[model samples]
Target chain A: MLKKRIIPCLDIKDNRTVKGINFENIVDAGDPIELAQRYVLEGADELVFLDITATQEKRKTLTELVRKIAAEINIPFTVGGGINSLEDAKAIIESGADKISVNSAAILNPELITEISKQYGNQCVVVAIDTKFVNGEWMVFRSGGKISTGLKAVDWAKKAADLGAGEILLTSMNNDGTRAGFACEITKQISEAVSIPVIASGGAGTREHFAEVFQETNATGALAASVFHFGQIPIPELKNYLKTQNIPIRI
Target chain B: MIAILKYNAGNVTSVENAVQNLGYSTIVTDDVKALRSADKVIFPGVGEASSAMKYLKEKGLDQVIRALTQPVLGICLGMQLMCDSSEEGETEGLGIFDAKVLKFPATALVPQMGWNNFTSLKGKLFDGINLENDCYFVHSYYAEICPDTVAVTDYILPFSAALQKNNFYATQFHPEKSAKIGLQILNNFLKL
Candidate 1:
């Protein structure tokens, strides 16, 4: 059976790992490479580094960091944020990152997803959707979750899958940093609708929350930032708990 | 020297880094002479089969790979292309392995994109790895169980996790990205 994955997301800003609350109020956690090595030692299934750096020369710094982390860490990792073109994707992937994720860029130019997928295989293209509930409906947000694209969450996910995205990284902005739980309803909606794998992100507070998202939704992976970075939940202990709960997890 | 074949694919860099991390020097190249003369060859790839096959044919790596007497291992798309055929893009493979690749059924997830364990392990690749050990996988098409199958992993159904015949070995999983167990497998291959 395919085991559910517990992924720790590290938001990167200028080559350092940081965690944000509700997409704001960022704080330094530690060195990106050191944190990556620790996560691998702690048995993180996979790692995701979102380059939250805002600068004209962001690409050089992110790629350098990616190269360093890739040289040290053995597990697969995805690099995202500010990757607006095929060239950007190539730089990170050539730097040794296994996959390149696109969120707001995909919405701005949907063809970017297909282009990257065509050049590299679809397996290396991850479409991350940051969605917030608006007017009683989940609307897609771009520009770091500050702007709304007015696209339905499920519809955009399906479109992304059609556009050659191998997996969907669905993050609920409304539930982000809340530490309540995952957006099970929308996650179920999107994961069920698409044939591709869905990684549920945002609102992961307790071990039960991870269980709830997996048990209630078809999400195969759950991602959180602060909990794992702050030592609120150790990955090995959490996997053991999920095993006790009858969820298929890799220990 | 270990040579990682470079031909219209991804993960060549990752594979090189993994081999180098294990204290083995590696060269990522498409030159026929370099690949053939290397002590071991790693055919690591991630792309469409038809396009990959086309590139291999254009560069004449198809014949070079088939004639090499040295140890050769393929990963993911590299493994699929080693088989007789693939349903992806209706592409014909290199006909090295006796198996055929097919997409997963609609009843299951298209791509098994996480860690999963394997059973019925065999061959030098499993020298230290156990059934309880899981490997990272990210693919939709899988090679059917055949005479060359050395290990099997169940996802949508039982399929080839690793295959071996003579000097040619292949894996459906990404050992470069599978962590310690993966490194163990790579070291096993290197020692062989």
Candidate 2:
């Protein structure tokens, strides 16, 4: 049986893990490799690094950081944020990222999804969609969720899959950072709509939240940042919790 | 020394990094001589089959790979190309493994791209790795179970997770991308 994956997301800024900037639980938690190594020891199935770099030079720094971490860790690692073209994707992949995720770029040009997937296999192209419930419907947002794309989340997910996206990283803005759990209703919609795997992101509070998302939706994986970063939810404890709940979590 | 077989397939760089992470130096080369002289040859790829087979034939890597006697590990697409043939391209493979790589039926979600556990492990690859050890797999096609199959993973159906025959061993999953247990698997392969 395919196990439900638990992915700890690291938000990178200027090549350092910034997601843990406010994480007071772990000492010096900003070190990407150290936290990633700890996560591996705790049995994290995979890792995602969201590179929120601002400039081209900083992007280079991010790739260097990717290389540094990839050299130390031996897990599935994905790099996202600011990757818009094949060259960008190639740079990151060469830097040792297993897959590259695109959000606003894919929305602006859906063909970019197919184009990248063709060069690199579809298995390496993850299209992330940020959706917010607006006016009673889940609408897609781009440009760091500041601008609405006016596209339906479920419909765009199907389109992205049609465009050769291997997987969908669906993050619900309404539930993001709220610790209210994942947007299961939309997650199930997209998962059912696409043939590829769907990774549920955004709201992950308790270990039970991970269980709730898995139980309610066919999400292949669940991703969270601060909770795990702050040591509030250690990955091993979460895995054991999920196992007791009858979830097919990786141990 | 490790020679990472290069035929322009993707993931060669990452594999080299993984090898180095395990404290082994590797050279990414298509030269048959470099491959022959290496202590171990790692054949890792991430790409479609038909075209990759085309490139391999054009460069004669297909033959060079088949003639390897030392322990050669094939990963993902590299593992598929080690079979007799692949349904992905209807292209003839190296025939190292008596199996066929077929696309996952449309009835199930393809690529099955994530971490999955292994069962029925009976080889050096799983040494120090638990029976229920999970590895990252990202492929649309899979090599069917054959007499050489040492491990099996059930996704849509039971497929060959790991295959070993004589000096040729291949894993349908990416050990390089599968964390500590994955590193342990590679360490075992290196010791072999």
Q: Which candidate is the best by lDDT?
A: 1
lDDT digits (tens) for residues A1-251 of candidate 1: 78999999999987888988889999998888888999999889989999887455878888888899889998999989989999999998989888999998899999999999988888889999999988899999998899989899999999999999989999999899999999999999999999988999999999999999999999999999999999999998999999999999988
What TM-score, over all chains together, does every model reach? 0.97, 0.96
Worst 10 residues of 1 chain A by lDDT: A53-62
The segments of candidate 2 whose C-alpha lies over 4 angstroms from its true place after superposition are A20-29
Residue A223 error, candidate 1, Å: 0.2
Model 1, span B1-192: residue lDDT tens: 999998886658789889999999999899989998999999998878888888898889989988889999999999999999999889888899999999999778877899999878998888988899999998889999999999999997999999998899999999999999999999999999
Candidate 2 chain B, which ten residues in sequence have the lowest lDDT sum?
Answer: B6-15
Q: How good is the docking of model 2, as DockQ? A: 0.77
Q: How well is candidate 1 docked (DockQ)?
A: 0.82
Which candidate leads in TM-score? Answer: 1
lDDT of 2 by residue, B17-125 (tens): 7788788999999888899999999999988888989999999888888888999999988999999999986998889999999888877789887788876788878
**Shift in Å, residue A197, candidate 2:** 0.9
